[model samples]
Target: MNPNPLKILVLFYSQHGSTLNLARQIARGIESVPGCEAVLRTVPKVSAVCEAVESSVPEQGAPYAEADDLKHCAALALGSPTRFGNMAAAMKYFIDGTIPQWLGAELSGKPATVFTSSSSLHGGQESTLLSMMLPLLHHGMIISGIPFSESALGHTQSGGTPYGASHVAGHEGRAALTDEENELAFAQGKRLAELAVKLAA
Candidate 1:
């Protein structure tokens, strides 16, 4: 085994903290595995009219992600709040800048998974998850999703899905995750970390 812990990047963008909650749970799952560590990262918001500028460091929450983070991670768990059935623009923007990593295959063959938070039960959660997977696929990542073995997927009324872990944040986008949602997110993270270890071996 490698003496240093494998770093699984928990990268996310949360407008109102719902997605961040999911990221935290996923990190817990990653850390549950021996020789694994979770690194949380977020992207800054963008402006529609003009270039949005902010400090290099975020005022709160996880530090803003950089290309180096992607290059060194052993695995990845992406999360975002749904935006009209797709990933939020901020997340996409960060992904768009990873051409160098893509060219060098920095993330190729790594284990990856995704998560999302939506405002409604049917508000495009699955679509958002799928959208996030596109860039990962281009980077040659191996995507993983929750399986039927996860009992929460069969009965989750709020967010769990076979596609990925998710949370229905409700119309106000302030709802807390149900017990099932939390379990599924944690399971997803743990699964990804385990896969990373196995693949590294």
Candidate 2:
């Protein structure tokens, strides 16, 4: 790890690969900023039945995100899949559990941005991003978004947005991210990191 890197947490819940892809892109963006580090994490799946269970640790990929990780981060990049114009249940479940962090103002004044992926072009990507911002707002995180100045926003025919970063994964949800989408996601990540470092200074 680079000494004095501004650690930014990239947290999400991705049942499918699209959200995970977006997370990876955002992490790359975060790493582009000098002296900023990206710590990727994910939330555990919630079972339908009360007695159903999952392993304490995930079987693969990044480890489950701890609440303390949110508290200590200098900034955050939140991502989730769209579920009826809302965020995924697993992601919502994780955010709801951060009451302690909110009460303590752990994330207050920190920069935050959100991203989402959906099957349809009109699949409510913007709403999903906005809804995710609600909890972060309660925590007093300053919102960050991609400005139109990024060329990707003006030219993308697929998934790029001003709300943050988004991708149109098609109905099958297996489409590779377009070059434009990837560029915008990286831009968003870099923008957030730059803002965080400036605020810290």
Candidate 3:
């Protein structure tokens, strides 16, 4: 057994806390596995028109993610809210800065997955999940999805999908996760952490 617990990074950008809720559920699943731990980290908001520098530390929620987090994780579970059918710019900005890690192949051979929260039924949750996967693919991580066997994927009314776990935050952006969304998110994280452990062995 690993003397130190394996770290599964839960990195995300949440605007209205909906995405954060999903992250927590994922973390819960990761922790369910013996000798596995979840490291929840978040990216900061960026300016639309110009470059803005956030403080070294975030005011609330998880600590700001550093390149080292990406370098050291046994696996990763990325989450974000939809931004016009794509991941938010803050996440994009953080990912774009990982050129060093990409060049070093820091994430290669690692298992990974994604999740999202959208404001509407058709708010492009799947697309946003795909958007996050594109970079993980480039980094050579093995990405997985919440398969239909999870049962929730076939019947979820809020935001669960085969692409990944998700939540419909409603227009107000404060809606709680439906039962299936929560279940799928937890399942996704558990699957990712288990895969990581097997790969390491």
Best by lDDT: 1
Q: Global lDDT of each model?
A: 0.93, 0.91, 0.90
lDDT of 3 at 134: 98
Candidate 2 residue lDDT tens string, 1-201: 567888899998888788888899999989988899999999888867621778878889989899789978999999999999999998899898888898899999999999999999999999999999999999999999999999999999989889989989887877478999999999999999999999999
Q: After superposition, how far is residue 89 of candidate 1 from its true place, in Å?
A: 0.4
Please give the lDDT score at residue 147 for candidate 3: 80
CA-only RMSD, every prediction: 1.7, 1.3, 1.6
lDDT of 3 at 191: 93
Show model 3 residue runs off by greater than 4 Å: 48-53
Candidate order by decreasing lDDT? 1, 2, 3
For all predicted structures, in order, the TM-scores are 0.96, 0.96, 0.95
Q: Please identify model 1 stretches exceeding 4 Å from their true place.
A: 1-3, 48-52
Estimate the overall C-alpha local distance difference test score of candidate 1.
0.93
In Å, residue 161's CA in model 3 sits off its true spot by 0.8
Determine the backbone clash count of candidate 3.
0
The residue-level lDDT of candidate 1 at 21 comes to: 94
- Alpha-carbon deviation at 120 in model 1, angstroms: 0.3
